[model samples]
Target: MSSLFDPAQIGDIAVANRIVMAPLTRNRAIAGNVAGPLTVEYYRQRASAGLIIAEASQISPLAQGYLDTPGIHTPEQVAGWRQVTDAVHAEGGKIVLQLWHVGRISHSSLLPDGAAPVSSSSRRSEAKTFTRDGFLPVSAPRALRDDELPGLIDDYRRAARNAIAAGFDGVEVHAANTYLLEQFLRDSVNDRSGPYGGSIANRARLLLEVMQAIVAEIGGGRTGIRLSPLTTFGGTTPLDSDPQALYGYVVEQLAPLGLAFLHVIEGETGGTRNPPAAKPFDYEALHRSFPGAWMVNNGYSRALAMETVAEGKADLVAFGRPFISTPDLVYRLSHDAPLNELRADKLYGGGAEGYTDYPTLAA
Candidate 1:
């Protein structure tokens, strides 16, 4: 049986266990979107996790959606990430940076000179994003000109380089969560008539291009991508045609890349709005589509996670809220200890109150 504590390999990186720390965004970075000492301590405390996927970090100034979120496109940001990577490594832990580009989900208040967010098409997302003031409505983003697609791809490539320079073990492309990449992938948001719109293949072009650029820069084994097939956010409505065909085609295209791994966010992030109870999608069909390590997240308990791995349904399991309140989650799971509950009030935009205050089990 594959145990949760057993060592596993996700591409080139050798993870000590299967208890991955799923990326959780805590708006606690410095004013310039730089990782600070507090961020360092937060990751170091949870080094026991099999692998840690750092919070979503913007790849450019225009990618900023939430206030105080970290970035990787600047020298100061790289230096700040170095502090975090060094701290985690010192504790014998492995960490990966999640490169993000929030396209239409961004607000003008978060952009430089208060410019509108950019996307594949000029459409306004009906979603609200976090800002310095509070959660505010998103605005229509400027469409990326046909000549500018290459530049956006270059931005992702440069961000991958910066992540490596910051001493990260690898980089996971934030193609999920209705962000920039997802914006382009979804048909509802991408109504352009160019090569990047209409058919599923065209919609998937940007993600594949970005992946190719990152692979060219750091090889396929050092790159990973996250996807949320069933999520509906940021004006991302499900295609009435056929979702299985759309997502299956995506997985088939990505399978041959031989990338690090594919992380899937099963459903909603948290228990915010109750997701409609529908029959679960055919994961076995989708899992076979990607010929690489697979990590599953969302409302997963230890028992369920272990079962999924033992049954060969998933290679690894990620925990989001559990890690938020339990810094020593892996140890607790290994010993069958009770976990601490997370306080929702301090989840986002807070200092270190409930962030790094989770206590570890004494020896």
Candidate 2:
């Protein structure tokens, strides 16, 4: 039977355990989308994790959708992240960067020169986003032309290369949480009539293309992707008759890619595992769809994580909010220590109060 402390290997990276510290957005980057000392200390404090998936960082300037989210496309950004990677490596921990591009989940205040957010179709999402002032309404996005997709693909490829240059162990494509990739994935939101839309294969085209381009730069062994099958996080409804068939086909297409692991958020993003009256889809069926190591996430406690892994339901378990208040979460769980309470007020766009001042067991 496998435990959370058991050793495992996801692609080329060898992890010390199966407890993964999931990517979390802290909105603490410095000017020019560069990570700084606060970011370094935050990750370094939690280096006990089996693997750390760093927060979502933009792949290009046009990819910015939040005030202080970090990026991997600039020389200064790379240098800033190099410090973070060095700190994590010094503590003998493995880390991966989650590359992100928020599509319609942005306000003009978050864009360059007040450019409108872009997505697969010219529809407005009923989602709100964080800005310098506060949470603001997301604008209706303009649909991307067929020719414009190639540039976005190149951005992902370059970001993967930059991750390597910045000394990260690997990179994970942020294809979940109703971001740019998921905006194109859900049929209800994407009404484009090109090769990039209309069917499961067509809607999944950009995601697969981006994966192929990144794999070309960094081998498939060092690359991975995150997927949310039934999460209507940003008010995205799947109008497709069968979401099971759609995601199953997507997973089948990804099987042969030989990427690292597929991170799946089982239920609603950042919410309960069993959402009441939600659309029903077989989790076991989705787990069996991908032939690679499957990572399970969303609303998991230490007991549940251990039980799921022991039952062979998943190869890894990722924790989100708990890690924010407990720096040594792995140790706390394994040794049955008490966890610190989370201060939700200081979660985003702050200095180091709730960011890095959390006490560990050592304190």
Candidate 3:
């Protein structure tokens, strides 16, 4: 029987416990996408998690979708992240960087030279993205040219290298939640007729290539990938035919790569969908499709997480909002302490007010 506070080994890193701090976007980075001092303090405070997956970080300038999100593509960005990783490690924590590309879910306010966002097809997502001003409507992105894919692949490789340079223990590719990789994987948005589209294998090529590039830069044991099989957010609309086959095939292909782990988001995060009704495709079946460690997240109570792990349905469970309000979530869970409520208004683009203000048990 595995407890949330019990130690576990994930890939090349030895975790302090089974509790993982899921990657969360705080929107605290400064200009030029450089992580600020506040960012360092925030992660340092939550370093007690067995493994800390840093916020969704852009792999390239074009990958920017929301204002103030950090990036790992620049030297300054790398140095900024080094400060964060150093602080986390000093607290005896292991952290992984999550590389992100938002694709059509981006707004012009966060784009390079005011260029439209890029995606597999020229389609506009009905999703709204946060900007410096406020939440704005996302624009239709330009279709990525065939000649530009190799460069995009290079972007992921460089981002992985940057993560290593930034003192991170590993990296997690963000292929979920209607981001760039999800945009490519979903058939409703990806209507390209080229080698990178049309068939399921072709649609999955870009994500596979990106994973390979990251693994090439960093060993497979140091690389992880996050995916959302039943995700429909950010203009991600999977064909109703059989998502099981598409995602099962993806896991099968990824199984041979021996990735560090597979992080899956079961369903909607900010919606009113019932958990029982929105239960994602059989996660255990999907876990079997992949030969690596499997982690499941989204609206999981402490008891539910414990039950899931006890049943061997998930090797590990990730907590998102609970971690935000409880910096010492593992300790609190261990002792059955009450968790502080997270203020919805202070989630994104806020300063250190709600970011690092959460009190620890010892404090």
Candidate 4:
């Protein structure tokens, strides 16, 4: 029987334990959207995690949606992340960057030359994004033409290469949470008609292409992808007309890629783990198709995580908020200790107060 605290192999990455730190957006990037010393210290503090999926970072300047979030497209940004990976490596921890593109979830103010955010459809999201002006409605996006898709694919490929350049062990493609890929994944949002839209395969085309490109650039053993089949991000986005068939096809398609792992959000992104009344998705079926490690996330308790691992239900368990408030979460869990309270107010864009100020058992 597998224990949650035992070491495991996640593809090319060897983890000390199955406790993972899910990618969290702190919006604390320095000038030019670069990870600074503070960002380095923040990740270094939580290096005890088996695998640290670093925060969602824009693959390009136009990929940004929130203020102060880091980017990986520029030389300065790459150098900035090198510091983070170095720190984690020194502490015997493994880290990977989450490559992101907000698509229609972004505001024009966050884009280059105020370009309208691009997406599978031009229809705008009712959701709001955190900008310098504060949370506001997302701007209408221009439908990405079929011709333009090659460039977008290249952007993902470049980001994967940049991750390697920055000394990361691997990269996790951010295709979840009603973001760019999810915008296309759901029939509720992508209303375009063309080779890039309409059918489920067409809808999943961009995401699959992005994954293939990244895998080719860095190999599948060094790549993972995150997916949220039923997450509406608190109804800011709607569910896919057929969440099961849609994600089912997605998981089946990704099986041959030999990915390192597939990180799944069980229910609502940060909301209920209990499947909603109307939305019914068989997550276990998806788990059965994948050959690599199966990492489960969203509101997991220590007992639940342990049982999930112990029962062979999930190979790894990812914790989001718990890791934020408890840097020594592994130790706390080992001893069944209490966790620190999260400073909700200072979650996004702040100094070390709520970001890295959380005390550990050693403190």
Best by TM-score: 4
Local accuracy of candidate 1 as per-residue lDDT tens digits, 1-363:
787789998999999999899999999998689999889999999999999999999999988898899999999999999999999999999999999998988889999999989998887877888887798888778998879999899999999999999999999999887788877887767888879989999988999999989999998888889987767753344532455677778889888888989998776555322357433566678898887889988888878888888888888998988999999999898888999888999989778899988777673
Comparing 2 and 4 on TM-score, the stronger one: 4
Alpha-carbon local distance difference test for all models: 0.87, 0.89, 0.87, 0.93
lDDT sort, best first: 4, 2, 3, 1
Least well predicted 10-residue stretch by lDDT in candidate 4 = 272-281
The per-residue C-alpha lDDT of model 1 at residue 150 equals 93
- lDDT score of residue 160 within candidate 2: 95
Alpha carbon lDDT at 318, candidate 2: 95
Question: Which one wins by lDDT: 2 or 3?
Answer: 2
Question: Which candidate, 3 or 4, has the higher lDDT?
Answer: 4
Candidate 3 C-alpha error for residue 250, in Å? 0.5
Q: How many residue pairs clash in each candidate?
A: 0, 0, 0, 0
Best of the two (2, 4) by lDDT: 4
Clashing pairs in 3: none
* Model 1 lDDT at residue 348: 90
lDDT of 3 by residue, 33-72 (tens): 9999999999999999999999999999999999999999
Best candidate according to lDDT: 4
Residue-level lDDT tens digits of model 2 in 1-363 = 888899999999999999999999999999998999999999999988999999999998878888899999999999999999999999999999999999888888778788888998888888888888888878778888899999999999999999999999999999988889988888878888879989889999999999999988999889989998778784644434566787887888888889899999987898767666467878788677677778999989888999999999999999999999999999999998889999999999889999899998988
Cand. 1 Cα-lDDT: 0.87
